[model samples]
Target: MKEVKIESVFQVYEGILELPEDLQELMQKAIEARQKAYAPYSKFYVGVALLLDNNEVVLGSNQENASYPSGLCAERTAIYYAGAQYPKAKILKMAITAASQLRTTLEPIPPCGACRQSISEYEIRQKSPIEMYFMGERGKVVRSYSLSNLLPLIFDKSQL
Candidate 1:
């Protein structure tokens, strides 16, 4: 018999102002993008900003569809667009922000499981770590140094 333990590491920031200047800027952009999300059903808005090695920033907002599973998350939307537009660029960092129209979200909101899987694909493709920062409408922000930190047991092409 064997026992295995899995743990995820996250860095907590009291507020956005506590972050570095560049990260503060990225978080602001994420907030702006979040306003454009089309989450009429859930009333929860999410936005993501991707920073590429080429010094380009791509923004994405959650788009909801009438069919529940038809919609794509902000993480995937930004990553996919960045992939199509900057095929040669390596994504260096990503900032995610989410807010709910129904109530004030005062804690960090991490991406869903599906988002983690989708993001792993890009991280694997670029052969580099993607620093991720996520936060709610207000309050604390959380950071993951690498996608691996969030999904310890990543399912990559090796599984195929």
Candidate 2:
């Protein structure tokens, strides 16, 4: 048997202020969206901001429900809305952030597994990569050039 290895790489910024102007703007929008999150159960608010190929920005926040599995994550909500509203447009970038009543997580907030698969579908459909920016504690940010970096060997239609 042959053993194979995979590696993922990303950049970490000192803080949001150190990011580029556009990325900083996107992060700000994510923060604003977080304010609207309806997470009464977890009390952890998550927000996502997407930049479409048409230069339009779309925002989404986590929506929780009484049924745990019925709730939707901020990333999926934003991605679905973008897909429905701008079917022809490609998602170029996405910024994600989260806040908790307890304390600020001192690490980048990565998308859940289900969200990663959902995001991979769009990337495969658009035939391009979607840059991602994740927020961490003390304004720290993580930048990833593509979803593949986060979800490698992903299951897609190509496998079917």
Q: Which candidate is the best by lDDT?
A: 1
lDDT of each: 0.94, 0.93
Return the lDDT, model 2, position 70.
95
Candidate 1 stretches greater than 4 Å from native: none
- Collision count for each candidate, in order: 0, 0
Work out how many backbone clashes candidate 2 has: 0
Give lDDT tens digits, candidate 2, residues 1-160. 9999999999999889999999999999998999999999998999999999999999999999999789999999999999999999999999999888888776789899999999999999999999999985346799999999999999999789
Taking all chains together, each candidate's TM-score versus the true structure is 0.97, 0.97
Question: For model 1, how does the per-residue alpha-carbon lDDT over 39-109 read when each residue is reduced to its tens digit?
Answer: 99999999998889999999999999899789999999999999899999999999999999999999999
Which TM-score value belongs to model 2? Answer: 0.97
